[model samples]
Target: MTDFESTDRPYAAFPVRIGLQVQPQHAQYADIRRTVAAAEEIGVDVAFNWDHFYPLSGEPEGLHFECWTMLAAWAEATERIEFGALVTCNSYRNPDLLADMARTVDHISDGRLIFGIGSGWFEKDYDEYGYEFGTAGGRLDALGEALPRIERRWARLNPRPTRDIPVLIGGGGEKKTLKLVAQHANIWHGFGDAETIAHKHAVLDEHCRTIGRDPGEIERSAGVGNKSPEDIGKSMLDVGTRLFTVSSSGPDYDLGLLRDWVAWRDEVNGE
Candidate 1:
């Protein structure tokens, strides 16, 4: 077993933060906007949306909005809360172009953008959008290639990003994905129970060590799905996860869970 206690994980000093993934499916944009507003008002730390052409759950043909465009609106509409796609599919757009888009939104939000990205998965999204659905390894390789281009483009852009826009890489593929996270991500978001996430954190820490990067520099983030603060929150917190995100889908976009998590965060952070 790896000694997780050896290195000082960066998140150990970070206060607990709660994020709300206002999934853009099965709801009108107005409702989505309202949800964001409510989240900000409730003092949630970050608001996020997934980058997909269609809904991930519910009706296949349900109402869905594009990711970056809606993010632009969020940038202008809200203040104080950071926002971005939960994880933008790297295959959907060119690396340089995506960098420019992220920079523009960064400016719009006065630097509240988190550049979350991942290797493309959803086959339907690729097929419907006319992107080639290649093998998983091929896609991961592409993501590995794209990240550098994205960074280089950010460096080349005029009126560069307001701040070093935080890069949040989502996925738990230990070999490729975690390696990428160790190489680039400022925040690493993954899905799993507390025990599983703790194991991933250990794997990620080892990757960081191999590359000579501080394991603490990358924040560990997880999705809180149906689990209350009392259920998995403390367990995740004890395991070094500083960022916890709860998702709410369109139409209703109920923020009750988000509010509960926010309260939990405040309690944990002693705010």
Candidate 2:
């Protein structure tokens, strides 16, 4: 759906949508499913899985998983947590087909899906998948074209998204990427500590203003480790970051940090 109506009032509190980007690179599907179910049951706001082939941090050729199929399963299994790929590569699928798949999963999840995506990166995925590993600019150009087609296809899909499917784009590229987020993303996810994230947030705002769109129309999010959630959370929150994420992975994916962040979310919400 339309991201939001442009507004002039002071922006509201960023919703505490905790994201757990469960890496599938080193984990079995059943094990990963268990981890996802547990997190949903534990009151996580968002449950995410990375769209990757090899383990990002562990064994390079470990037991890995594809993104869309796993997300389809996640949609059916979890009833609570909003689920999606942490960011799907724009090059991997035709944008219209991707939109249709997202719509189908939206129905399957009864509208708990977030259409998270990004311009393709990771040369390995491109090489292995046979997608052109072109320049970064070319990939972002693909994304720019794909997003509108995705939106258009969404309108023509037989069954509309059960709920407005939120488009979540993750990146920190200042030029085309941030501008795309301003134009299309309902949520822009960034990976950085407080200072880096704050800088990106301002850049995103400038992009929005340049396009005549209000920056706060999109939710600004960042992913950080749980080691300093308190300080990071307070710091990012001070600078307009509402969505904070801690990524987890493995055969026995732990939800300990996730629970702690949930408590932190309550404390902040209480304040």
Candidate 3:
């Protein structure tokens, strides 16, 4: 099937959700905190920070903060916005420990948590942190193994998660990534233009069909980085995408772009 081929599938049952990933780099904690607070005030549904030790762009050694800790802070700070890492690196922490942390954060947020995770990438994060920089396939294999452990730990935790913490898995690797999405993810995040997203959507659908899971059960999320939110969001919506994420970085975690996207989402959902 071509990229543009429609699956004749129904739109996702949920209303459109707008997410803002405020990169925890080149900024102070207070600044990041303000950004998230502003985002929630402006009607952003989800607030995200990526898991990494160093900056991913701009100055490499620029100021940066840790992921889960910041997520915990975000949990305490925001009352309405659901929060998590855009995609937590599965290789960074032991799976069981991660589950417990997630549970704690769930309580902190009073049940507003989305446990977004993915196979580890970024050799720099691995090498500098003394983690083995293995091949991509190896990392994915490790992730596949860890996901089950995380779930099992969640089940066994004392005062279990306040809710079934939604897992949002990122990436568009057709074979392994999409397979894991079908098996595990409640929300699947992919980055690309409309055509690329449509193609991956088709691949994800196939994976779901193979696993006897309905594709509509997993929400599709797209990253709209500094793009025309209205134009691109409309395209994404046409192809069954309901979550649109816009990422802004620190020093000054501006939400002007995000505000536009939030407005677009309100229009789409008639909120």
Candidate 4:
């Protein structure tokens, strides 16, 4: 078995992707676009934005925009950078329709879309949007049902995704969520330090084994919060994780951490 908790694996090996989640609350479209441009110019691998109606941090009534629409605009604005929501609320749209929208965005980005999705959580997004924010279990149930519908829709949608758009599921719920990740997600993003991540990863491995899926086929990812990549840099790379994302909340959209993380990725990857 490959050890994913040490930073000595050729140090300069494996595919490394550095991502930034641009918090779209309290920012103008111009600033958001500039942030995207800066991230691309600075060599960030993937630039993302969250899908929310109300700001998660700061003033709840602050500025926030819809996700897929911003993504489509990002697709048209930037070149050479992958784009998607950090995670889209699954309850907001029909799975088939979501898949089709992703397909369209894929073409717009010349195949740079990552279909990052999750079961809808924030109650405001559900309530105000007229979506029923069901129980967490029910929501996971919805997500599980949505994934296959999306894939099927992609296969059936005329013109298809410009590329085989990857599905990224973010959640750490071991029982149902990780199981779904094992079965369907191309990338899995979770919130955990090394030990928790290792435990969850092991559980996911077991899930993969049970379902006859290859664990190696899924790329592990995590959000970089509070800690600078400079501090936890090697630890992240050690854990079989190739995708690193740092989230920036708006009003500032500060990217100092993200820039540092990107540098760390480049160094670790020998770029």
Candidate 5:
């Protein structure tokens, strides 16, 4: 048996959740706002945007909005669905400052913020934004150092977070990233097909064992990239992935896929 199968998976207790990534590119703020509202109305469990200065897809120089600021606006625009960047780059802001910003947003959203973060990538963002384009290992090390500072900052904030903000770290690196996920994340977001994701889960579970943390304590999240729920959702669910995200890019933030995923989630959860 694989390491994950050898142990009991307490993740069955977590209900299936659907997330929509409202890609902040090629669209106006109004379109993005409307999309977030629609996703909330459709009963998505979370809304997310990526942390990037430019578009990751489609016309590279296309219109784009900053991540955290848009998230703060999402806090005010939507009422129920939790929201945050899919993964904020650790190199962009000071850990303490980021913590304070997250705390403020959490309070604004009435504790609905999910603080998803990761090591820096997308070198164009670094070069254009005037941040250092460090080695990948250096960025990972920085992320490792920043996580604790962020937690400590939360403790010291004036009117601390409304609740302990859930930290969602996104990446699939088996060594440093998975270990960091075991050490700090409440949710681990990865990108892959079922076999790939199942392998990552096993690695993550092993990391949890080394740290003496329960593997089930960390939620598993994956992207539903153009695949129908009937095609890939059951396999992902069988591997203990409870959060499935669909990404909608703007000018037209088509949510047809999101609707399918939401229906699938409800069906699987017996809602």
Candidate 6:
């Protein structure tokens, strides 16, 4: 067995944070806006919108809004919850330009922006928007190239980001993706079951060691489905995962599950 199998790396001690991703599809912008406000009032730590041109579910041509613009609106609309795209597609915008947009939103939200980004998938999004739509490997390669440029651009922005602006990289590719998570990500948004997450954490640990960075420096995040939030969340938390996000799509954007998770978070955080 590898070092990941060893029990030496204790669970990273940190306050649990719960986030809600209000999917920006099949709903009027008014509904989406209202949902965000409610999520903040309910005491979620973060609010997120996915970056996509069209709806990912329900009617193909449904009421949908652009990602960054809605985020700008969210920055002004809500007070407490930090917000951003769950995972903005790097291929959609130039890296430097994306960094600038993030900085602008950061200031607007009074430093309440989390820069969550990932390599673009969803061929439909690429085809409809006239992008290249290359292989997954190609997209990952492009993302690897873009991250540094994005950071460089952040360094040069006139009004620097209100804070370092946590970089959340989403994806579970073990080889390249996990390596990038080790090198750059402040938070790593992941997927899969407790076993899957444990394995990913182990792989991430190996990469972190290779890069001479502490694995604890990058917070572990995962998406929570409706299956059994309490059971699954506890198992994940045992493995050092701290930030749990429950994603719901519109037209309703029901956050009942998210609220439960938030309560669960408080219980675990010892509040």
- Candidate 3 residue runs with Cα over 4 Å from true position: 1-7
**Error of model 2, residue 65, in angstroms:** 0.9
RMSD of 3: 3.1
Q: lDDT by residue for model 3 over 8-59, one digit each (tens)?
A: 7544565788999999999999999999888988989999999999999999
Better of 3 and 4 by TM-score: 3
Candidate 6, superposed: residue stretches over 4 Å from native: 1-11
All candidates' lDDT scores? 0.91, 0.82, 0.88, 0.84, 0.91, 0.87
lDDT of 4 by residue, 1-271 (tens): 2333344322223477889999899888788888889889888989889888888988889888888899999999988988899899888888988998999999988999998999878998889878888799999999999999999999998998887788899999999999999989988898878778878878888899898987878888888787887576667667667788888876767878877887877676666
Model with the higher TM-score, candidate 4 or 6: 6
Give the Cα error of residue 77 in candidate 6, in Å: 0.8
What are the runs in model 5 whose C-alpha is more than 4 Å off?
1-7
Q: Write the per-residue lDDT of candidate 2 for residues 75-179, one digit (tens) a residue.
A: 888887788888998899999999999999999988899999999788988888788989999999999999999999999888777777899999899988899
Task: Kindly list the per-residue Cα lDDT of model 6 for residues 1-271, writing each as its tens digit.
Answer: 2211234444355568999989999889999989988888889999999999988888998888899999999999998888888899999999999999999999999999999999989888899999999899999999999999989999999988889999999999999999999999999999888889989999999999998998878888888777446568767776767788888898878888988888887676667
- As for candidate 3, its clashing pairs are none
Candidates 2 and 4, the one with greater lDDT: 4
TM-scores, all candidates, are: 0.96, 0.93, 0.96, 0.94, 0.97, 0.95
**How does model 6 fare in lDDT?**
0.87
Of 3 and 6, the candidate ahead on TM-score is 3
lDDT of residue 95 for candidate 2: 90
Residue 197 of model 2 has an lDDT of: 79
**CA error at residue 226 for candidate 6, angstroms:** 1.6
